[model samples]
Target: MEQQRAAHSTEAVVGMVAQTFLRDRHQFVGELSQLMRTQLPVLDRDERLRELMEAGTTDNLMEILQFLQNEAGEDDVRAPERALAYARILAQRDVPAAALIRAYRVGQAGFLDTGMRYAIEFGGGGPVTTSAIVHIVNRTSVYIDRVCEQVGVAYEDERDRWSGNRSGLQRQWVTRLLDGTVTDTDAAEQYLRYPLSRGHLGIRAWTGPQLDPATAATVFDQLRTALTTVFGRAHATLVVPVDDHEIRMWLAWPAGTAVDSGAIARALTARGVPVRVAIGGYGTGLAGFRRTAAQAGRVRRLALLGGDHGARVLAHADVAAVALLAGDIEALREFVADQLGELAVDNERNLWLRETLRVFLAVNRSYAAAATRLAVHRNTVQYRVRQALDMIGPHADVPGGDLYPRLALQATELLGTAVLRPEPDRN
Candidate 1:
């Protein structure tokens, strides 16, 4: 009976400590997440992965706390859903299984240390303290062991499933190429079955998530075929599905081959694919491969940020200036506002004036050329330019010419109302 009472007392102490930690869950989660990200850099790759790591940490901590508070058997323990999801993502991302295991081990050690501190505080460093610590260690170890085993299974299953297909193999090679892990161009070419020494153009295509899987697959396949024909029938093309709604493609052609973006856009429209595309500059050899892919990625990000501005195809060359300026959106907006002033307002009249000024400046301030481009009379173009310049103040006529106003106008064209002062609601 005395031993039974002692066991009850230890259990109560462990539960109390767990309760204390549970109340301070946020801090514990932050510490664990920071530790995981620091120790396992793979988990820190992107915002989505970091978010998953934090969520998994929180779920695992909650599960551990609940286990400590209850008298659950070891067999009853299971890994949390979010933790399993995180393990699967790591697998999909080609992170090593060892790294996933180390994350658990790291987390287990940290949790144990924290639990020991609480146990010592509650039991006051006596026999009760020793008993409480022992109880905590055994239970926590069981929990970690069981959860790790489950997550390991999940990771392996996902890795097997993901690596079983052709897209998986392509993704692995593409990832290696992009990350500069493969330095031998011949070996990479042999593995990818595409010559790395040839000229390369990278493309990113994506559709809305509203498309069903079958429709998305068909659209992507059509895009691949269309691009292959557009680049040239003789050249090699590689297409990798990024996800359900997106794909990354690389087209290789012999040196000096001309790529017509207009033709590519027309072909997609002909097929009614209903997709948006970001095209990178044409580059040659291994350096070109990486550079073009990076450019396409940046353009894709800019496109997503700007929303649908009637631009079905965005090329890196065209948006390079805007893309660079858009890196710091707030600063870019401030620059636009500072340069254009009232011309940055998001209204019909201001938009027309901005466009006329942009065209006038683009065509070397030639009134006739700007009028031709705008499909308006030269008098009207001249009038709008004068009005725009007046609204823009003396800065538009800055000593160095239209450099500042030109950049702001380009941003206004690409970003639309994003950098513009909002139009007041009619309501």
Candidate 2:
């Protein structure tokens, strides 16, 4: 009877600590979300997805807190709706199931740390504290195990359902091709119905979320028609939808046919669709297909990062240097600031100077050529180049002279507002 009373007392103390955490649930959830993002960078990819993950985290935490507060039996436990939804979304995004499982494990560690800290504070570091900590550990472990099982099931179900469909099959093949996992070219060609031996140009086309689904579909269709018209209908083309707003396409031409990316861009522009397109260089066979697709993907990422400064149609060859630097954006931004100094400022005057200097340098410092490109007089090009040099300070005088400054200018040109200093807010 005495032992039973001691056990009951520990349970009550655990409930009290849980109540304290529940009252400050928002703070705990915020910390847990940050921890998850830090440990698993994939969770930080999309704002909407991050928000969903937060909601699911909140729901899961609340359920666990409630279970602790009421001393609820294991039979009463179940995974929350939001948590299941998050699992399904992860699966749809092609996130590995291991990531989903790792999130729960990370969350469990964070919660346990918080719970242990609160237990000592609530119990004043005594036998009661020890008992409460033990109870919290045992209960939390069981809770995580049960929730993970349910979520894992949801993830697998969604993965299987998603991959069983036609688009999913296409995505699978494309993924295999891109990753260089497909060894049998004949089998892949048979499945995709697009020739693998011909010259291939990969394309990525997407639009902002502002377009409704029907309109986006129409725009994509127009994009397809434009491609066929420019590349000729005789060539085999394969279009695979990456998501509701984006697609991955490959245009295959007869071996040795030169691909005119400029013509393709003009065609897309003439169509006037809201879609933004990225194209990769022509490659022949499986190696070329993979290389071109990878390049297009990198260009797409660079374009997205470029935001308002990105062109409607971008080719990988044009921005290959910038694409290499896009992966570590913070470092690139820092380098831009370091190299250009005050000229990196995103005001009108600075922008004018930067462009003039960039053109002047591009033409081997020929004032006449720079003037022709800028549609300004030779004097204006010379004057702007001097002013840009002054603004850039001594950093522009590196050992290689124009080499470093040229790279910074190209980054500024391609990235636009992304690498430039923001105009200060007067408000």
Candidate 3:
């Protein structure tokens, strides 16, 4: 009779605990949703509020409650499956595991505080009920710890799985085509599912390493959207998967498609992906694709060398002058030093002089125009131009002598070098 009575009382306490949670489900979920937004910076975005709120109020809340209520705790068979599925959802949405774990810890604290208080008040504040509340709190803590560990395991497993096949057969096919390794163009094109016989305009884009891979994927998606917006979805076909850090795209438009490379560059740059793009002119067939891609590669190299020129957006046509002078770096360095004479010397005053000369030449040697662009008085511009002319002397005076100085300035702007200093002595 005694044992039976104790067993009945224990069952009633468990029922009371579960009832307290279920009765206030709306209040509980609402509070928890607030906690999630406050704790998880990634979930704090206005676009993410709906998803974050759903995690607390929908079927997921029930699944989480079930794991917490199970007597077997983490040993419950459903627990791993539930945790794995939830983790996969987060992974697919590109939420980091650390953020999810932090959110879970925050939820744990909220659940224990609210649930324990409800359990005690529901038990009418007696000594026996207070002891029971303590037991419930201890049990809840252990249950939450076990569930969290299991969920973390699931998150890591899903993350590992994500990195497995992200760069696979498609990447291999595209890479082989780009390198000119495969001669069977038809077989390659079929494998790649890209039309090689059609006109192609190649593009190469890449982001800095500071972006995480999942974030990089989002950036790449934005790049695709920008391309589609500029070129129309039908024309911007063939987004060849080229791993996380870089993308190689080909637009299958007609030969006479009026592609403003400047507009395309601006569209992609506006997406703010920390991306630099190289756009190539349209050409037909396999050879055309390869040639355009090569041109894009050269333009990309120049963009890298150019530094922050407004933004890192380049096109083959805009970079043609730099491309013509690509070979022999040492000779180019010598030419810059010789053409500009004493003006190429590395000093603050000389740098100011070189910049003035560059601006003057860029505006067709108009002193007034250069002054307007540089925000200086026209007399300052005239004085600076005369001084620079004296420093450059007859080296830039012959027929097309201006060409050498102009090319030197252009090389300095594109290559980031006016002169190469001699190596220091190892004394």
Candidate 4:
């Protein structure tokens, strides 16, 4: 099987052989692994590729593969050379065959953006965390959009005007694709650095009820466009999960970007496609970006529990404390007991009072409304609400009955925040 006939006789070939020979860092050298792949990493069935790609295994090589595959669909080069180049990219990076195949489908994505993060458990990006991750993800997005636009296809402009800086090569690609200046064979053969390194992540989702490979691939390539629309220059590693079941993504935002998950969700939904988005929870670098994506899934699941059906943003800070409660009602109640047991000391402060307060808050500050909503007498509602206020402040209701329960509610709800954790149900 290793027979060599018309094997390429150039640097590309040498890169491929080196990538094919080296194994994992444990087996050989970590620096070598990084260097051989030239950063992007190789992808293929060759054991050499697997070992070489071992470091950035979780990176989105599959997404990149998908992007190149699609581009090849219409690339003027029209030669197998382009695919060969992509394969070379994967080979150079040491990506395993399975991974390379998966990456080839990335071309279908709208686009992806990479963000930065800085956390201990997950990865972190220090102070400039958000900028770093966003830059990586967004830069990739523009590169691909430039490709689509050059190909004379419809591609949306980023809502945010942030395209970091364009590399000369990417700019040339855009020019050649748009101008039809590159030879058909060359255009078809060009797909450099696709599986080059493992820095980028992917954001991919599907629409068709029964997801096919083509549809899935297409959606992923477009994800960049979707992400760039919101996160601007944030570079992202994007991936569409098998089938049309989910949109998996990783990216970061600046310290003060104040991401609007609801807003991002609405935008995808507007496409009238069955789009799903797991906006990475804000953080610094790569690992942090991964954690952000993980958190996004958690928030999306939580939103589902709350009946928000489709795509969503998962904010880490908002979900942090709550996500720790381990997602259990009783666990949350127990936490409440431990933290603010004093609130339950009196009739107005007991479990029942707390429940009444919860129901009240659930219905807003309307006592009659809360009572009606909870199917209880208005007086009963008033009594419970008053007792809750007593726990809040003895004299809080005297002049400011209005503020008493509100304060108590805040104090009481602190314990309720932890019920959002999505770990396996221990209940």
Candidate 5:
């Protein structure tokens, strides 16, 4: 630890550390160097810090000191990493000063014992402001107010992720895997190189044809690679196989990427899949992303449902009717209605089954609750589900899994809208 601290003498090491809190590393280092250079007054400092400021310590300490002093502390203006780490040591020991913790280390999150992330800030970090700070208290208060707006969103996002980890999140190797962004795979967050990405902003798409599982899977692979090319290497593991057919898929990504509509449209056209990319609108953090991605999935369904000619894809705009299209809600319903719905010995039973289907969808086709609501034994529920499957016949297994059940529900809902349930935000 001491050696590492001593390594701070090297500008490269200091730059690496500084990156933990600020954006634009090279630019930040330049400005910081300038500040230290101008304000340095003397290369030597009080005994404790002198070891870090020795002329031989780093090539640029004196220069950086000048920048810090010349810029009058403004040189460290966005040095959130340094400030955050500085704050961490203080906070860990219970200093409780206002501070901003920098973004997560590339793969250094597991060490984050509490998992209580403050926010999903694009910039590094800042002081957690409330009613503190003696000087600039008013200014800090205003900025803190402004930051709070974002903080709520970021905080909520982290919380959602926490919940996902508990009851919902996908598998480690398969579901939540991060492949490192295209721009940053070769870059090391540990070394302070920027995470070169599509601005940490973009969407992960569900791609492929409903008819061909092989084709869909191939398309999945292609688009995974293609989108990676477009957005640069971004995390794709959040995407799950939607159906038996490999063509259908789902993706989640950080916001603010350059893979816009026209570009995606053109790319898909060139690739022969002819895509409809759903731009999950601008929201903060991962929870915001999941919400947006689900919205995008719905939009894709809507577009495909819209009977839009040619190969179909969905972007954010098509959300209004995400449900009506996607797959066989009717089949799913028919499957449910046959298996579970038919259990209704009367009209009320039918209504109950309808409610069951609604619940299933609201819960993203979860099986356990669908049984509980029906007020039957789980095995009986399972048996009924099997029976429904038998009744629907082979088409029920239509690839791109979301469809059969989705289409079934769609048909049922279309036939009986007043009776169906609303799809929850899943937020």
Candidate 6:
């Protein structure tokens, strides 16, 4: 008899809770919306979030009411199923699960408050009433915890699947083109909407750390704008999001249009963020597109490896010799030592002498021209040249034995030596 009485009281209280929820559902959702605005600014500005919150809150209340009225088993799965749908919707709209989870928590509090108000106003404050109210709150709390867990798992799975689909499709086309397996040029050009016959300037831009979707989109937008400014506003541009941290772009222009790599470099460096941009020389035709993209990728790798730490923009043409030598570090190191000899010591005095000698060779051993370029007297140029020859032996002579030394010194200046290498400032 006591157990029967307890069951009857529980049913009555649950009926009252259901009645109160139905009466105040609008107000309940409104209160949830208010809480969202205060705690989650992103959802406050989103219409999808508003609809999702209202629907999810209503679902939870109805599910709990049904469970209580029917004495339904705990494993009915309605609550978790609704939560999974809510998660899929949120993922589709690109809303973070944190916001939805927070919304659920806030809505749970509001639901409990409504039930408590009904317990006081409809049932009065008695021992049985207190027990029923506590029981209702505990059950509702457990249900919400289960719902949140289900939603989190669903959201993560859906988000990964969506991202994988997008990247997989993009990767297929890009990889095919890169590997030179695209047999139908017309179909490929039509799909990409880029001219296969025109020249292509490939660029790869990336940040050090992975970026959130919103931030990555913003960064890519800025990069596109900078490209338009350098290339042309009307140029056909192809952008491929390689991943969360990297983007590859190709700007197609006419055959005769000149691309100023230096100007593009300046714009990227002034972007007020730590970005590394690699620019590949313009190539004509379908073959050119792949070649340039490959070059940009190499330059980006070198930049990421601290070889170009101080360089904001690296051009393949400028780093061609260094890139070739980078494959064999030991050989390059030995070559630098042999070429610069004592001058490769990385001291200020040695650097000065090396610079004079480089300029002297650059102008066909014209001491007067090197002096004019260096803004020093001709005799000073002559003195440095004689000193450089002494340090490097007869190999420093121009037009005969100096070719390799000149090339190595140029490589050292471009890519720095293996030890005490110079950081790339701006390429």
lDDT of 5 by residue, 296-371 (tens): 5455444433343423444454333434333554443435344333332224434444445445555555578777
TM-score of every candidate: 0.64, 0.67, 0.54, 0.33, 0.27, 0.54
lDDT of each: 0.83, 0.83, 0.66, 0.41, 0.38, 0.71
Point out the worst 10-residue segment of candidate 4 by lDDT. 153-162
- Deviation in Å, model 4, residue 77 alpha carbon: 48
lDDT, candidate 1, at 79: 96
* TM-score sort, best first: 2, 1, 6, 3, 4, 5
Q: Candidate 5, overall lDDT? A: 0.38
Better of 1 and 6 by lDDT: 1
lDDT of 3 at 26: 78
Candidate 2 backbone collisions, by pair: none
lDDT score of model 2?
A: 0.83
Q: Write down the lDDT that model 4 would get.
A: 0.41
- The parts of candidate 5 lying over 4 Å away from their true place are 1-212, 235-237, 246-255, 274-277, 308-311, 317-427
Which portions of model 1 show Cα errors greater than 4 Å? Answer: 1-160, 397-400, 423-427
True-vs-predicted CA distance for residue 189, candidate 2, Å: 1.0
Model 2's C-alpha root-mean-square deviation from the true structure amounts to: 7.6
3 or 6, greater by TM-score: 6
RMSD to truth, every model = 8.9, 7.6, 16.8, 21.1, 23.7, 18.3
Q: Which candidate would rank higher by TM-score, 2 or 3?
A: 2
What does candidate 3's lDDT look like per residue over 60-105, in tens digits?
A: 4465445445565445534344344555546544568887778777
Report model 5's TM-score to 2 decimal places: 0.27
Per-candidate clashes come to 0, 0, 0, 99, 69, 0
- Which of candidates 4 and 6 reaches a greater TM-score? 6
Ranking 1 against 3 by lDDT, winner: 1
